[model samples]
Target chain A: MAILEVKNLSIEFGGLKAVEDFNLSLEKGELIAIIGPNGAGKTTIFNMLTGIYPPSNGTIHLDGENLLGRKPFQFAQAGIARTFQNIRLFSNASVIDNVKMANTADSNENFFESILRTPGMVEKERQLDEHALELLSLFGLEGQADTIAKNLPYGAQRRLEIVRALMLNPKVLLLDEPVAGMITTELDEMAQLVKELREKHGQTIILIEHHMNFVMPIVDRIIVLNFGKTISEGTPAEIQKDPRVIEAYLGGGFHGNA
Target chain B: MKNKLNSILPPVVLVLIYFLIQLLLSKKILNPYHIQILMFACVNIMLTVSLNIVNGFTGQFCIGHAGFMSLGAYGSAIITTMLFGGMKMDPNLRIPVFLLSLLVGGILAAIVGFLIGLPTLKIKGDYLAIVTLAFGEIVRSTLRLIEPIGAARGMIGIPKITNLAWMFFFVMITLYITRNFVYSRYGRASIAIRDNEIAADAMGINTTRYKVIAFVFAAFIAGVAGGLYAHLMTFIQPDSFSFVKSNELLVYLYAGGSGSITGSVLGALVLTIIPEALRFLGNLTNWRIVIYAVILVLIMLYKPSGLFGGKEISFLRINRDSFRKPFNKFNDPKLADKQNS
Candidate 1:
């Protein structure tokens, strides 16, 4: 059975169809990439998937449960976690705090328990600190845990955002343009990190990216979008040769490298 | 044992300070006038710190805090004066009654805060500020039309039941709760909302719920402060909680450093005392306003983030070592080499 199934998902912004009849059946542990040009409704699709934007028409099912009409936080609680296209760290907060903030839904302490500093609350807080530190260490960010998030280098900020999203322990992780502004070295590292995240953690993932080189190596399957419609869907080899995808996106100058 | 000491230390220090003030008052070293100023400072501390939760930590713009304070003032005044005014009760009983009145007023304000926050918080930035500003004006105007609480003429003859001890007690309570809230998971959520609401929402935090919670909590504290203010002055008036009063609380919050609890306390205390202290200039007292303005301008120009600049004093911090330990580990050569590898 598919872990996440979207049927005929469509959204219109003021009579302009942003995403039309988008459909997918993602199995557990599968990694897919959505490749598109600028303004191809890639981020808008992500927004709909995470409940940030309610689709004009469609149904989303996570583990057979319908998720239409739910709020973004509810979507997060329902195991759909995502990182923004533009990095959105809690800039003023410390690095550790940015990660811990994502675990708020997991905290069981009530207002009275927290304010009164009950024994259980103290224990929970200590555990939270330890857990946050462990996740930070995985990304080599533990050393900078005390630094304000915005003060970190750009690559570190991008990595920190992924770490923050991972704290949610989502069933399906959606990353929107995770390496938009990365240098070559940072891009390779991010590619390696994303590959590791899937292999080691068994995290089922869907990502939107414009970096063909970055997307070609890491993703198992590719879905090409153009003008708010799916232009192609296949493995990397098949997608690389698709004449329609070549003409619309890769262009005549393109040569298959993979 | 060490943990126990750390837990008990703050309250013990507060108690000692309270007793010292009491001693000074009894010896006449601190006159009634001085005591009045101290009480006002305590009340302002409560107002400023509570306001900090919404405007500072939660990152919401709320300029109508005085509206909640007025609700609390009126609510408590109605309880102590209108409901229980005629009885010649025992002095000991009076304390409990006053405490109950304050609690009632606080709860009343909290309910109103919750009501107003639900719809208003959906809007962002400048629009929210304008709505809150208008809310304050609406509250003030409505208070004038009500005949039961003396209407526009104001309610008078309320008993002066608030003493230095009571003021000190509430101040400690306000500070303790604010400190604890800021450090807790819920408090972290509020800060997250302040930092980036969209990110916080995507992180599974119920943004609207937390925003309303902060608003209601701040309103409750402001209401309690209002009750204290009403009892201290032995009168209740709508004008006391005008937009100017709300702006004064904002000045206290910002001028002291908005996000820091210690900054709020210091801002309220220092700003409140400076105006009074300048009275010693006598005929030159007119120049005192000029001096105060200059000090404010200097602080803004030199340290726009306020005195503490989002940093807390060590005594008020819950996890002082957490920040220092990471920097030490970062500087260690072994860790740097491991990361490089």
Candidate 2:
């Protein structure tokens, strides 16, 4: 079943429409990729999907529930999460602190419990620490758990973004250009991680990727956008052969060779 | 046993130290003027810590804290004069009524904070700050216009129920509650919003809810401090809680280091006492204010983020490590038995 369905999504800025008549129906556990040129409004669509920008016209339904008129946190509560294109993190906080903040979404303990240091609250706090450490370990970030987030190397920062996003345990994860700037090794590791998320955790993913090689092999399906409109949609093999995609976006597609 | 001893020792030591100060006061070793200054330091600590919750941790610039304080002052003062009518009440009855007045003042300020915060907090940073400053001014002018509450001439002959003990108790409560709030999920969520609102919201944190909570809680504590201030001076005045009072609290928070409880303690305690220390210059009481301003400027130059530099001392960190094992032992019969045995 389609876990998320957007019909005729549209948004405008000033006089120009940033994204128009966009349509998407993502199945549960499916890995879908949105590909386009620099100004093709890919990020804009992600922004709308994640409730950062309210669409001028369209309906976004997650799990058959209307996502319109809901706050970003409410969208998150409905099991949708996203990472940023520019990597927004609590830069002053430690790496573990970043993950811990997001992990709090599921914690139900109150401040009184914290004040009195109740046993259950303490155990829950320990669990939170363990869970955050486990995630950091998965990303090879356990050693840097105490390091301030902005001090980490660029690659680590990118990885930490995913770690923070995953902390929400979202059913549908929207990763915006997850591997925008990465070496070959980091790109491969991220690709493997993305696949693992779907295969192991059954996480439904919608990704925006500029790297052709990264987007081509991993995604079950490809969505090509040009000039704020859906130019083509099909399997990667089909998308690779589509003439409109070649002329509009591919032009043999941009690849970083990772 | 060492851990148990360590846990029990700090509070015991704190009580002993507290009593020593009281003993000195009772013996007249410490003059009443000195005691008054010290008590005022404790009250400033409460106000500073409360403001830090909103401005420092949540990253909102709230300059209307004095407005909440004023509300609390007036709320409790009205109760004191209306209910008890005079300062010559029985000691036992006076203590409870004073405590009750603190509660009334805190609740009244909290309600006003909710009303103001709900509409203003939804906007951007600068706008929220402007609105808060405006709120403070509005409260001040409104109080001035009202005839019954003594207007600008001030409410006189109020009960002077506040003392060192009362100040100490409220200060500790403020510190304890703030420390707990900072380590809690709601507190982390507030910090997250401070770091990045969009990202925090994407992670399923209700940013508006946390922001408002922090604002209201800060206001409540500030109100309680205000009640203490009114009773401490035995007077209530609208002009007492001007923009200057709000700015003074902010200065104390920044000087101690925002986001650090120990810093707030150090900042408020020291800053409150500095002007009095300068009085030794003799007939230059106003020069103390001038020197205080210069020191603040120097502080801004050399230690901009404040003395602690945003690093918390964590003596009262709710030590999750301490909380974990023994606390859980209560739930597990086997663990409890093992400990007992």
Candidate 3:
């Protein structure tokens, strides 16, 4: 059964249509990649799916529940989580604390518990801290937990973003340009983490990626977008041979492999 | 063990020093006028430190801080005046009553904050600021229309209970609580939202909930300060809690550096003492206001981040690295075990 389903999704800003008739279904523990040229509305699709923007039309279902009108945070609580294209790691905070904030949403902790520091509160905090650190360690970030997020190297900041999202323990994870700024080695490490995140954590992952090499290896299937609509959907090998996919990337004049 | 101590030491030391100095100054060194000036300084510290939680850490501009203060002052003053008005109680008992009243005032102010914040959560940046400022004005006008509290005549005969000890004690508590909060998980969420709301929300943070929490917490502290102010001045007036007073507190937070706890404390202390130090400009009170304006503008132009620029300062070493030789590693297995378990 599909874990997340989007039907006839459309988004318009003022008079302009930014996304139209976008549809996709994600199954449990599956890794799917959405790829397109610039302004193909890849990010817009991610935003709408994550409740950053209320869709102009259509409905989204998470675990068979309607999800069109909920706020981004409400979506998070409903088991949908996302990370931004730009690295947003709470720059002034320590890396470990950055992930710890995500754990706060699901924990049965409150202001009184934190301030009073009762035995229950202490135990809860300890468990949260451990979980957060384990996530950092999964991405080889345990050593950087004490450093200020912004002060870290650019590659580390991007990794921190994924680690933070994972802290929410969501059923579906949405990543926008996870490999946008990484060096090749960093991307490879990120791929390993993403693969582990799916296989071990059992999270269904949807990523919007421009780097075809990164997407081709990890994604179970690929969706192609062009001018705010889904143009093609298939396995990686099938998407690579589609003529429209080439046109979307390099205009109609060129003939090349995707 | 050392790592745990490092996280909790600064706020403790700062509060201890504040009370120690208050005790020493009251006993032998300072006169009543100086004591009054210092009392105001403590009040300013509470206001600025609390304001920093929203304006600095959460990145929300709140021009309604004085409204929260008015609610707190009125809430506590009415309770104090009504309860202790005609009774001949021991002077010592008044302090506890005053503290209790302050806590009550803080809670009420937090409720008002929640009410205002509910409608304004969707608004951001300058627009949100205008809404909050209008709330402060609304409170001012409403107070003016009320008659039982004397309205324009001001609420009078509030029993004076804001001694040096009480004022400084609340100030210390405010500082300690705010400092601890900044280092905790809530603090990180607040800063994350402040740095980038969109990203914070995407990371599964309930941004609206955290924003309301920060605003309410800040308002509560502002209320406590207002209570102390009412008792210290021995008068309560709507005009006293005006936009100018809010501006005064904002100036302190901005000049101190937005995210630095120590900076807020220093800003309050320095700004409080400056006008009195310039007593030579007696009839030129207008010049004092001009100078204050100039100083604020100059600081903004010269140091946009203020004096400390969002960095913590310590007079003594608190981190374990200070004692451990060659301790440059970013992570320690032992530290990780301690944090986890």
**Best model number under lDDT:** 1
- DockQ winner between 1 and 3, please give it: 1
Give the worst 10-residue stretch by lDDT in candidate 2 chain B: B332-341
CA deviation > 4 Å runs, candidate 3: A14-17, A250-258, B1-28, B87-93, B280-298, B313-341
Taking the candidates one at a time, how many backbone clashes does each contain?
A: 0, 1, 0
The reply for model 2, stretches above 4 Å from the true place, is A114-116, A252-258, B1-10, B23-29, B86-90, B283-286, B318-341
Against the true structure, candidate 2 reaches a TM-score of 0.92
**lDDT of candidate 3 over B1-341, digit per residue (tens):** 55557656755765787677768777876567887998999999999999999999989999879999998999999889888887777788887888899989999999999998877875766766888899888888788879988787889999877877777667767766786567555776788898878777876678878888888999999998999899888898899888988888888998989888777888888889988867778788768867866887888899989876687765221232332323323346565454344
lDDT tens string, model 1, A16-128? 99999999999999999998778878899999998999999989999999999999999999999999988999999999889999999999899988877787887788778
For every candidate, give the share of true A-B contacts it also has: 0.69, 0.61, 0.42
Would you estimate the TM-scores of all the predictions?
0.93, 0.92, 0.88
Which segments of candidate 1 are over 4 A away from where they belong?
Answer: A255-258, B1-6, B23-29, B82-84, B320-341
Clash pairs (backbone) in predicted model 2: A250-A253
lDDT by candidate, in order shown = 0.88, 0.85, 0.81
